[model samples]
Target: MKAAVVSNAGPDWEIREVPTPTPGPGEVLVRVRACGLCHNDVLVGQKRFPFLGPGPIITGHEAAGEVVGLGADVRNRRIGDRVGVPWMQGSCGQCAYCATDTSLTGQTAMGCASPRTTGVTVQGGHAEYVVASASGTVLLPDGLSYEVAAPVLCAGYTAWSALTDAAPGPNERVAVVGLGGVGHMAVQYASACGLETLVVTGNPEKAGTARELGAANVVTSGTELAEIGGADVIIAVTPSASQASEALQGLRRGGHFVVSGIFPDGSLDLGPRSTFWARRQRISGSTHAGPARLAEALDLVASGRVTPMFELFSKDRIEEAVTELTRGTSRFRAVITY
Candidate 1:
C-alpha cells in the first residue's frame, strides 16, 4: 500500500510504500478511495501535536472508501460497505462523560477524556488501506461519491455541527466569518435552512465566490457586518482567534457565536467586559458534534442541498496538495484520490 508519510525533520510528506493495515477486533479495514487534507494535517506534520511525538505519521481524518475486511465482534459493518472514517474514531464508553451522556447520539471526541482520534492517536487514512472501528464509521449515502463524502467527514461535519450548536431561530440570520473550506460549507448549510447568510472575509477575491455559495451579502470585516444590522448567529471558521474576536462585534444582542476552527496559540480578546455583559451574547465551541450530525452533513451533500468545492490530487501528488493547503491556495478543500 502506498501512503503519504510525514517526516517531522522537514515536516514534509513523501509518497512511500507502507504495509497495509489489518482490522482488529471490532474494527474494519477500509481500502481508502479518497481522503481530504485538513489544516490539522499540517500542524501534525510540524509536530505541533505533542501526543504524536517526534517522527513520521499519517495525518488525514476525512477518509471515504469501501470496507474490504471486517474483524471479530464487529456486527454493524461488513465487507463491501461504503463508509467514511471520521476524526472521532471511538471513545471509552465507561468514562464519566460517556456514561452520563444520555442523548444516544454517541459521545463526541471533544467531550471524551480518552478518545481514539484518527491520524492523532492512531493511523490515519492518507494511505491506500486504513483501519477504523466499525462503530465509528458512517455509511456513505448512495448518491455521494468518495471525493465528495471525504470532506464531509470532517470539514462539512464541523460546519454543520457549529450551525446546529448555535440553535438559530427560524427567522434568524447567520454570518460566516471565513470563506475557507469549512466556512464555504457553512454558508450553504445556513442558506439551505432558509436563513439569510452573510459572509465576512478579508479576501476581496472571495466576495464573488461567497455570493455564489449562497451568501446573501459579503462584508470585509466585523465593522462592515455591523453596518448592515448585524446577524443573529455568527459562526467563526477561521484558524485565527484574533479574526474570530474581531468578528464578535458583528454578533447581535442575545445572539450566539460558535467557534469551530482550531486556534492553537491564539486567544479571543473581548474588547471590554462591559460590552459582552451588556449584549448578553453567548459563545461556544464545536467540533464533530456526533455520529448523528455527521450523518446529517452527509445527507445534505447527497440531497444536493450542500456541495463541497475541492481540488483533487492523486496519491503521488500528496506533497503538492499539502503545499497548496499550507499556502492557502486550495480552491476550498483538497482531496487526495487513491
Candidate 2:
C-alpha cells in the first residue's frame, strides 16, 4: 500500500510504499478513498503538538473509505460497507467520563486507560489502507460522497457537537468567531437550527462568504457586539485563546460560550470585563464529536442543509495540500483523494 509517511515532527511528508494493515479483533480494515487534512495534522508534523505514537507515522484522521476486511469479533460492519474514521478513533467504554457522557467524552479520554486516537496515537488514514475499530467507525449515509463525508467526520461533527452542547433555542442569536472551516460549518448549522446567526471575523473580506454561509450579520473584531445586541450563544472556533476569551463579551447574560478550536499555546485571558462580576456567562471547551453527533452531522449533510467547500488533492500532492492548509490559502477544507 502507498502512504504519506512523516519521518519526524517537521514540515515534511514522503510518499512511500508500506505494508497494508490488517484488522484485529473488533476491528475493520478500510481501503482508503479520501482523507481530510486538518490544521492539527500540520501541528503534529511540525512537532508543535504532542505525538504519542512512533515516528514514520501516517497522519490523517478525517477519512472516508470502504471496508475491505473485517477482523474476528467484528459484527456490526462487513466488507464493502462505507464508513468514516475520525479523530476520536475509539474510547474506553469503561472510563468514568465515558460512563457519564458517551456523546462528547472521547477527546477527554484520549491517551487514558482505553482510548485510542487516529493520526496521533495510531496509524491514521493518510494511506491506501487503514485499520479502525468497528464500534468507532461512522457509517456513511447513502447519498453522501466519500470526499464530502471525509471533512464532515471532523470539522462538521465538531461544529455540530458544540452547538448541541450550547443548546441554543429557536430564534436565539448565535455568534461564530473565526471564519475558518469550523466557523463556516457552525454558521450553516446555526442557520439550519432556526437560530439567527452572526459572524465575527477580523478579516473583513470574509463578510460576503460568511453571509453566504447563513450569517444574518457580519461584524469586525472591534465592533461592540454585546452593546448593540448580545448573542445567546457564542462559538469561539479561533485558534487563539485570547480571541476565545474576547468572544465572551459577545455573549449575553446567562449565555453559553463554547471553545472548539485547538490553540497552539498561551493561556486564556478572561479579564474582569469579560467573565467577571456582573457578566453571567458560561464557558466550556469542546473537541471532536462522538458517534451520535457524527451521525447527526452526516444526516444534515445528506439532507443538503449543510455542505463544505473543499479543494481536492491526490496522494502525490499531499505535501502541497499540507502547505496550503498551513498557509491558510485554501478556500476551505483540503481533501486527499485516492
Which residue runs does candidate 1 get wrong by more than 4 Å?
Answer: 51-55, 102-107
Q: lDDT (0-100) at residue 282 of candidate 2? A: 81
lDDT of 1 by residue, 1-338 (tens): 98898865678799888778879899999999999999888888888874442246888999999999999999999789999998877877777887876232323566666778888878899999889999888999997999999999889998999999998999999999989999999999999999999999999899999999999999988888999999999999999888889999899999998888788778777876547767889988877778889999999999999999999999899899899988999999999998
- The all-Cα superposition gives candidate 2 an RMSD in Å to the true structure of 2.0
Best candidate, TM-score-wise?
1
Candidate 2 residue 261 Cα shift, in angstroms, is: 2.1
Q: Please name the candidate that would achieve the greatest lDDT relative to the true structure.
A: 1
Estimate TM-scores for all models: 0.96, 0.94
**Clash list (residue pairs), candidate 1:** none
- Judged by whole-model lDDT over C-alpha atoms, candidate 1 comes out at 0.88
List, in order, the clash count of every candidate structure.
0, 0
In the range 1-338, model 2's lDDT, one tens digit per residue, is 99988886456998999888889999999998999998888887787766687658788889899999999999999899999998876766677766765543446545346567888878889999989988878899997999999989888988998899888988789999888878888899989888999988888899999999999988875246776697888888887777776767677877888888787886567776443446666888777656888899999999999998889999999999988888788877999987
